[model samples]
Target: MTMSAVVMRKGGLELIETPIPRPGPGDVLVKTLANGICGSDLHAVTHGAELVDGFRAVTGADPFDLNGQVVLGHEFCAEVVENGPGTRGTHAPGTRVVSAPFLLREPQPVLLGFGGVDTPGGYADYMLLSEDLLIPVPDEVPTDTAALTEPLAVALHAVNRGSLGSDDVPVVIGCGPIGLAVIAVLRMRGIGPIIAADFSPARRAMAATLGADIVVDPRETSPYDSWRSVAAVSDPARFGRQTVSFPGFGFRPSVVFECVGVPGVIQQILGGAAPCTKVVVAGLCMEQDTFYPTFGVLKEIDLVFSISYTLEEFGQAIGHLAAGELRVDPLITSRIGLAEVPDAFARLADPEQDAKIIITPNAR
Candidate 1:
């Protein structure tokens, strides 16, 4: 049987009918329920080869082959349809679930939807998932909300890598989905006096709605300096100076999250950071970026890089949504069907248009 899918060809995304992918051993067939358009998906469609090369450079294996059609959807929710051979029926048919977006394999794990000609993602009517990585969704959580497990897990992992202290203030540099997700996770952890910055007023509003104490537009006020309002420093001007900690005075160092993965953002954050602050890099900047090492060295700033989420973090994300601990419903700004996937991609190029867009493959 053939299924409709939005494939990333050499040119761009095209809706076409292709045979429904059969699940391999230790895999299960899943009917797409809901999928979120990720920034990575946007990069993958346009810079397929560059992404592949970067993936190869980082992980030493290229999962996406530009030579063939690629279906791209990583953040998604699906319903179990059938179990493949050599697989135990852990989740029965009709059960709603989400996976890690990786198809466990022999040589290496294949990135589903981005595995080129073989594995398709949630952009289609059906796809394959590893039973080992499947997490059952609770009945109360909306499918769209459950679909966010992947990205939320990403935020959770980034937060984990941060190793935040109770007194450390967090400053999220971008209010995009990842940055907003970081803010949500920080709020969920009860890490307060959260400061978020973005150029777009709409996104800054979203950041505040997600529990950011202070949201600023970098153009007007600097995010690094926004912390001074909440910090109980004896001398506000001395807070971010290049000297050692003043234990007598209440000084909270900033944990700046570079969510805007552009070239100059790191340098900008480094320049604005306080002494001994930790800067967590969560944004997936695909291009070659440059930053001065001296800026970080002079401030004694700890630069940390974060990537995909762990399985435990993924499960935690599901639990957070199921328990309503993190109210992420606001993160989803729009919902579209498979037919509108191509158009939605274009709209997402403008950051102010929407934060997260969910794709309902079978929506009527």
Candidate 2:
């Protein structure tokens, strides 16, 4: 007997029946209840972002061996249907949780899945997760809210990189789900004068609700200058407002976070650095190495890259959702079943939608 999975084929994603995996010793079998449609999933299908590793290996005289493929989701929540025999003091029956989704190959191994890395993910009915990678979902958190654990963890990681000060003016360049999340988490941490930039009015409005002090629509104005009015160093020519001080030419930020993963935006982040500012990196991409020497030499900026969250952060994020400390209900715009994934992908890929689409795999 088998359950079902939403399988991605040559040109599109489809639903298919597959074997229900049996958990071996030390394994945890999860019956997936909900999974978030991550931005990385959009990149995976369109920009070839998901195949960065396999894409690299096949280039320049390497074995063109394309191997295994599985379901496609990383931001998710599941129930422990079957726990392995050797797993004592572990997740018992009826325990629901969110998986880190890594394969758990220890000894300081490679990273995989989520938005940043390439790995098989969780767009299915029943999936296999390592016992260690599973974090308990709080009882007060609904399954859909618990599904947001991964994105919230990522947002927390980005905000933590700020070394955030209470009065510091923080700016987010992209107001996607992750960007809005960064906005939400930064406010929760008491950082103010937050600015969120994106081309969509809907997104900017959403960001405003998420606690952003100002919203910049890249479609109408430059995000950099739009933020300048709020920043101490206001450029009168750009903002049409005077009486604001500049951090000095070639100024860096106290801390800056880059949430939009584009090559040009990457350069902007490096260029926008203020002296002694820490760049809390949070974008996902497969672009080649891009950086300029003058960026560091001219500004004396600190560039730091944060990949993913530890289990502790995951737990904290879950607690926020459970306690209603972090408001995510406004972030989630739509809920759909397995059959609607294709159309869902199309909409999210457009970059015009302001809401995060969550998937309910168990919904029939």
Candidate 3:
């Protein structure tokens, strides 16, 4: 039998029919229910070679040769249909689940979706999942919501990177899916007065809905001004101490999430932040970013870079969704079929388009 999948070629995406794969020993064959289009997916299709080169430069090895095609999708949920030979587990067929995309074949890590033709991903009718990586979705969590487990885990990990305090004023500079996820998780942790900045009005509105106490358009009004006002009321002593002030602005950020990924944003944060602030970088910036070292040195800012989440973090993401602690419904802007994936990918390139687009492979 054949299944439809969205394959990433040299420069674009194509919906192709491929043989339905059977799981090997210690593996499970999953029927894909929902797969979310990620910002990384957008980067992969648009800059396949560059991404591959960057990965190779960092890891000193390539998971897959960039010369070949690969299926794209790491954030997804599926139903187990068959447990492969020698698969030892209690999970039976028809169990809804999600898994970490990293598969450990040897001692090294192999990415499921981006690892080329050998390890296909969830942008298809079915995918082969490693048994150890599977995490069952609760009955209360819808399939669409469960599909967000991966990205939410990412957000959780990013948030964990920051040292958040009860009275610390948090700021998020970017209202993309990751930024919104950060806001949601912070709210769950009871962190308040989150100041979010974005150029897009729709994203700013979404940030407001996702528990951002204050949302500002970077193009119109500086987010620094709004956050400073709140910081003044929160900590008045900083105003009296001129030594820690930045250009006479006594307000300082406890932690700032740089989710924008573009250049200069980090510099902007460093320039405005007070001394000893922590700035977490969660965005996937492909190119080299230049920031003013003098500002970072003067502020003594702690720039922390976050990557993938741990298995425990992934489970916690599902728990939050099941417990209704995290908001997933509002993030979903569109549901598409396998055939529409190419167009959907293109549509997501628009800065003003939807937030999250889920691909339902089984849907007609």
Q: List the residue pairs that clash in candidate 1.
A: 113-121
Off by over 4 Å in 1: 234-250
Candidate 3 TM-score, C-alpha based: 0.94
Q: Candidate 2 on 210-323: residue-level lDDT in tens?
A: 998878766776655645566554443322111124333432245677887777776677675444556777887566657786776555666777767877787789888888
lDDT of 1 by residue, 170-206 (tens): 8899999999999999999999799999999999999
Q: What TM-score goes with each of the models?
A: 0.95, 0.83, 0.94
Error of 2 at 182 (Å): 0.6
**Model-by-model lDDT, in order?**
0.88, 0.71, 0.84
Rank list by TM-score:
1, 3, 2
Question: lDDT tens digits, residues 1-364, model 3?
Answer: 8888888777777888888887777778889999999998888878777777888899887655555778888999999999988788658999999999876566665687775545678898988888888899999999998999999999999999997876678889999999999999999899868999998888888898889999998888777677777876545654422444454645544788999888777888898765767899998887878888988877667899998898999989998999999986889999999899889988887758899999999998
Candidate 2: the clashing residue pairs are 73-122, 233-245, 233-246, 251-274, 252-273, 252-274, 252-275, 253-274
Higher-TM-score candidate of 1 and 2: 1
Cα RMSD, model 2: 5.5
